[model samples]
Target: MVQIPQEILDQAKELRAQLHAAPELSGQERETEGLLKDFLKKRTTLELVEEDGWFYGVHREGDQLPNVALRADMDAISGENGPYHGCGHDGHSAILAGAALACEGKTLGKNLFFLFQPAEETGKGAMQCREMLKKEKIQAIYGLHNLPGFPLGTVMIRAGTFACASVGITLLFQGAQSHAAYPENGRNPAFAICRLVGELSSILSPENYQGLVLATVVHLLVGEKAFGVSAGEGELSLTLRAHRSEDLALLKEKICQQAEALAQADGLTLTISYQDEFPDTTNPPQLCQRFEAALKKSGIPVSQLQEPMRWSEDFGWYLKETEGLFFGLGAGEDCPGLHTPEYEFRDELLAKGIQSLLTAVFL
Candidate 1:
């Protein structure tokens, strides 16, 4: 295992902590991208190809052969409910930047393409940038995420399905207005929304929805925020996550059925839309084997996960388009679960993650 210089590690940790304090939600990673662009400037020669919050850098040594792509997402989540790096994304970005710094003048007979993507939180960035990569003619890809249950310096690798599919769903209900005194005059959408919720909840079983069919009413509003007036319009929003495509489609069908039934019964207008759909991630065995070998060479013990994660990732889309491997950088037994308010990314993993990526890049 190559030891990462202390001076470099300290600088990476400082950058991670600074990013953790102020994270921008999806599409809004202007400042974060700016910070990364500036950081890369001090490291290598990066030519901006596609504008609009996305960047690519090349580490060239008089030739470009065996071109490979390394990606790190730059967007933060909403329930990040405010800026605190519970997901260790800050750590991911830092490691990517650190790997670039470490690669200065280092040649593996392969060219490096560093992609700092935006809006992974919204599940749209990968597909948007897909067209540009075709011109680069990249042959290999490797990405990483921090795992909470494993020890620092530990890496997790598996052949297939590292993370499940995730879709963010939003539904709205509208009904005719009526007087509170005359109950029969108009339909009450509040009651219809309640009924739809109940029916949807009952069908979300472990067998029916696959991995996790969670439906949360993120927004439920009726009337003009006044109890005295009868509501003419009502809105309800939810997020749905599924392990299988069948389950995702089934859940969507059930939601539409329940909405239609509720609309007919209550004489309300129901509008449902699916947003922020992130497909399930499947790791290529061939590519993952390379990483697994690298970890073993580094003397890092790895625990293979028994199952794919229920949490969704936009990285899955890339796996769909090309052969790739996404692994977990273990954060230790005491690390907090991702997206928690109190959870903070482990600092020790910074060195391990950077080393792991560097090992893969050169191998």
Candidate 2:
């Protein structure tokens, strides 16, 4: 196993703490980007590349194309205090930085690129980085996330779909308002809302689709709370997930169709909007094997997951462009859950995370 120098690990820990203190949400990652750029410039000798909100550092002796790329997300999730690094992206960025620093002045047979991405929580960053992949001629890519429920530094991954595809859908129902005393005088969508909710629940069964699919009603807003008036406007928001992108698309279409039919039957106008779209992250078999082999060679404990996680990751977009592997490094068996207010990234895993990334790059 290659050990990360103590100074490098300490620097990474300090960087992670600085990032956690001031987090940015989704596409708003300007401060985080600046900090990362400054770190790379001061610590690594490799030339850095910047495009949009994303950036990368390349290490090569000649004109050889990069054989593999390593990526880390730089944005944080929303928190009660403000934007927070509750998802451990701050650690991810620092780890990638450590990897870049480790590769400096080393003569690896293949070229390497370290990518720092933005807006992963909102599922838009990877798609935007697609252009970078093409320009860099990267053959394969690798990424990692910190998992909370496993032993610290344990590597968790699988060969097939690692994470599900998901999207957020919003349905707006508009109808005529009427006085509460004469509710019958105007069209009300309260009935339609109830019917749609029930129908949406019915769609959650796996038997209705080829694989796992789920629809969660995240938010609902009914008509105004005025005591004298019956509300005619209502909004329903749902997050839909499926193991395959095709299945997700079909599921989305079915939900929209059912919603439209219900709105028509109730004499209401329906409008739909989608957000936070994520594609299914499918790992190529050979790349996954290489990742597992690398982890085994490093003497890290490896956990092979039997099923794809229900949560969505924007890194799924990268798989669509090139073969890749996305794995998880366990933070701790009893660590707080991701995106929760109490969640803090495990500083002890910094050296191991950096080494795991370096192993994958050199594998």
Candidate 3:
């Protein structure tokens, strides 16, 4: 295991606490960005590059090019009180910083890029950083997320499909409204809405496809709240998820087709739009083996996941461009789940996460 200085660990803990106290939401991460930039400038001897609310630190020697990249997400989730680091991103950022600081004067054969990304919770950060990555020529990238309900400091990973694909779809139904007493005079979409909700069940059942496919109704709006008017316009929102991108596409197509047919029968126009799309994160077998070997060599406890996580991660976008592994560092066996108001990052995992990431990069 790489030994990180006690001073470095202390600084990381302080930074994580500061970040946790003042969290920023998705695209609005200006304060977080500024803090990170200043920290990198003051602590590391790396060249800083910034673009579109995301930044990277590059350490180069002679003509050697950067082949491996370590990514850490920087944005937090909106909590009941306000924005907070309920997803452990604050710790992730601190780990990346600690790793970069430790590598300041180290010698290595390949160049290193420490990427700090924003808006990971909403699934837009990775897509925005896609163009920036194109200029780096990175061959393999690695990222880690803190996982609750697992032994602390344990590394959890799988070979393929580390995270599932997901997308949010909004269905808009338009029809003519009429007085509640004279509903027959105008087109009311209540029937279509009811039929669509019933048919949504058809999209479920993983057996329909070779892998897991699920469509969940997140929100539904049926016309105005006023009781005097018959419901004319209604909206339905569903989040689609699958183990593979192809399965998600198939599920989306089937849902849209069913919605259209129902709308046509009820004399309503249906329009479909999507948001918060996240691609499935797949880890190449070779890359997974390499990462696992590094963790074992460092004497870190490792766990092999029996199945891929059902949650979606934006890091899946990065894997599309290069071979990479996204693993999980256990936060604690009894820690609160991520994205909850009670959730807070475990400070002790900062050093372990940094060491794990550094080990993977060097391997």
Among all windows of 10 consecutive residues in model 1, the one with the lowest summed lDDT is 77-86
Candidate 2's displacement at residue 243, Å, is 1.9
* All candidates: TM-score: 0.88, 0.96, 0.97
lDDT of 2 at 220: 93
Candidate 1: lDDT of 305? 78
Top-scoring candidate (TM-score):
3
By descending lDDT, how would the candidates be arranged?
3, 2, 1
What is candidate 1's CA lDDT for residue 48?
49
Candidate 3 off by > 4 Å: none
Instruction: Give the Å error, residue 166, model 1.
Output: 1.7
List RMSD in Å for every model shown. Answer: 2.7, 1.4, 1.2
Report the error of model 3 at residue 316, Å.
Answer: 0.3
**lDDT (Cα, tens digit) per residue for candidate 3, span 126-164:** 998866566888877889999998899899989999889
Model 3 TM-score on a 0 to 1 scale: 0.97
